[model samples]
Target: MFDGIKILNADADIQKLMYSSVLDWNSVVNDGTGEVVGRTAEYNNLTLTIKEETSLVKVTGSLHKYANAGIHNADDFTPERLAGVLDSIQKLGIGINSALNNLEFGVNIETPFPPAKLLERLICHQRREFTRHVSKGFEYYQCEHERQFVVKIYDKGRQFGLRSNLLRFEIKVLTMQVLHKKGIGIYTLSDLLNQKLYPKIGNLLIQCFNEILFDEPTIDTTNLSKKDSDLLINGRNHKFWRPFSESNFETKQKYDTARKMRYRQEKRFRQMIDSSPTAERLHKLAAELIATKWEILSNPIVPLLHYTLNVEMGQSIIPTAKECPITGIDISDQKGSSRYLSERTLKSDPELLKSLPVTIGQQRRRKHHHPEEYYVAHNIRNAASNPRNSIKRRIERAVKNTPLFQADEVIRLTDEQKKILQSVPSNVPRNKKPR
Candidate 1:
């Protein structure tokens, strides 16, 4: 459910605990200056880096790997397991309330088709083109990096060398403002312990994928009428349905007719895709992903024994209860936690293991055409006369200076304000300017 995370500006005491007998920290020196500027340490699959100048400690690693013996995150990371991992971190003196600088949530699922083929067909996301990237053996398609978030659809099976056709769809939240906009008020690690919020998070992930525009190869034009063929062909090129305007066209009637034609075409095209066989299968996978997420997130989380996933057998293996090295207490005797998944249930119902999937839909329209000769002048004109309204202007302002966990403080007021404020009278000779 959750993967890579970064904790920034850890407390002094927590920094000491990270460098104590628990893990050894080695000094990092500047090659040119020969001066120690920081210290770093690797604990399991997690890494902690400390800067000498600011005395700030940053921790970066996969929460899934940390919970699963510092190994691959190819299995379902249940909410119950997440709670146990959070408990262990709290015991280690790393405050669970620590603010997260970066957070990623995704699911690994066995796709109906090859992930590579799917990536090839995935052309655009909200009008922004996808940039292909390969890290390790995993291949992924990602949209242009935005300040709020980055969406990734990658081959998880290839990354881990699994024999299954596993695809991972993830959203990397670069800022918490994105979460705030989605009504997810998570600010720190402690907020993640709320099992009730799992459905909201799952829905958010689904929504991100839903906004993607797919160029489905399954669309066949052979049996289609002229009208259907026009929509199918025009919709695929994203630019054929351009916005109509007085400057673009000579007459108002002409632009109006063009706008109406494209509008009708777009509506019909959406309906066509909604009823198509390929679309149905894609939506079905999305439905399954959300259902599984809801089931796991709603489960009671507890400090249960650590478990590992057996990919071959598709089972989660939990060994016999033993004392934890950090806390010096029996794992079964932990207090103040909910008993969500017991040892008996896990062994008997390994079939409960599953993952998530999603679909996409969104479009972008260009406002004007540029003169090829005047590149510099065209860029200046575009920047000054861009089609940004009040809401977009506010968002741009917020993105410039907002903190990761503080964007909530600077949003617009709700609609339930005073009626006077909602409908202010225009200034006149008799109307005095209000201070």
Candidate 2:
């Protein structure tokens, strides 16, 4: 339902309101950038999204989503929630214009002005317009009039055509077209947000469109009513408004053939009447004729250009949750169910409960461990591990155990122990004796 239409600019206040409505199962937040994105959990049909940026807050959820949410009332508008959100924003002083979707209407038209003649006067591009529907032999040029409206005109042949669009005497103008015509001087949307600029730009465009279509001398047909002109000009609907009927006629002949037959029959019938003796009585029949063309086309052709203009009107907002209330429930900045640690969720095992703190404390201390405890544990482990030193110690122990050293009550170092200790120097001796 959303047709790529959105409010590009929004105040932070409006964004804050949307943030509350977003569901939090898998919500994401970035404190560094102050960006928050969330979708309404309950309003699943319509994924209401909210974005909080540095300059502006953006809230986007088209009315189509709400209509699909099954909240329709038989007699009321199909998607009533859209109306509610519109009301909520309006209360915030944001113009309704900010949220309206774009509208487009067809504007194919005809005038005394041919595309070539119009091209001479206006800015337009050459086109190979398909004219097969109306008749095989017609050419036209399509171009922009005054660098404004999209205008098309038939050139080579006559016999109303199947133009790109059906003909209307009045031209159509779109909202964006109006803005383009206005160019640089018009007030910006930021001004509209501040309520300083006019919000009814669509209405303004409608006026400009009417002037370009109706008041323009080139398009104005002297006596034709717009409605009559439209019908008369768009007479090329051969298939839908078929020339032949089911009750009569051979195969469905071409539109030109049917037309030629009517003209010929009228001519033969007139010849028959004139061939009678009454032909000599024609000298007696005479009457006055005024400007018949002017008389018939006398009606003013009010150009009825189709316009589906965007309506934008925003109001002041207090910038809080109370500003725009949602139908579901009050939204909290933090989304999710309550984190209540009930008895069922608590640790039930006694040993696990007692050790939980110690486990947590140890894990916590790793980040901020005591320096003394670290080195004390490090010093207890022997790192040097000299192989020859170990052997010398083992030999000394064996010598002390012998009767030579243990002869007395006190175990003293014997000459054999000293010799065993001195046998291997701290520096390993490289010299070897061959036995």
Q: Clash totals for all models, in order?
A: 2, 19
Q: Write the per-residue lDDT of candidate 2 for residues 1-435, one digit (tens) a residue.
A: 011123445433544444454434334477686556532233423233344333333344433334444342111121123334444544433445443222222112222223333322221122112121233554443434343444333332243333322122122232344544543122222222221111123223233332221111223233556643443233222221223443465555654577576445334433333344423211111000001111111111221122112334333421122100101112233223311111222233344234222311232234555443232222211111122244356455656767465544433333323333444321233484211
> Over the stretch 294-318, how does candidate 1's per-residue lDDT look in tens digits?
3333332343445442222254434
Q: What's the lDDT for candidate 1?
A: 0.59
Error of 1 at 21 (Å): 2.9
Query: Candidate 2, which segments miss by more than 4 Å at Cα?
Result: 1-4, 14-48, 51-55, 61-85, 90-435
Lowest lDDT sum, 10 consecutive residues, model 2, at: 283-292
Where does the lowest 10-residue lDDT sum fall in candidate 1?
353-362
How far out, in Å, is residue 412 in model 2? 99
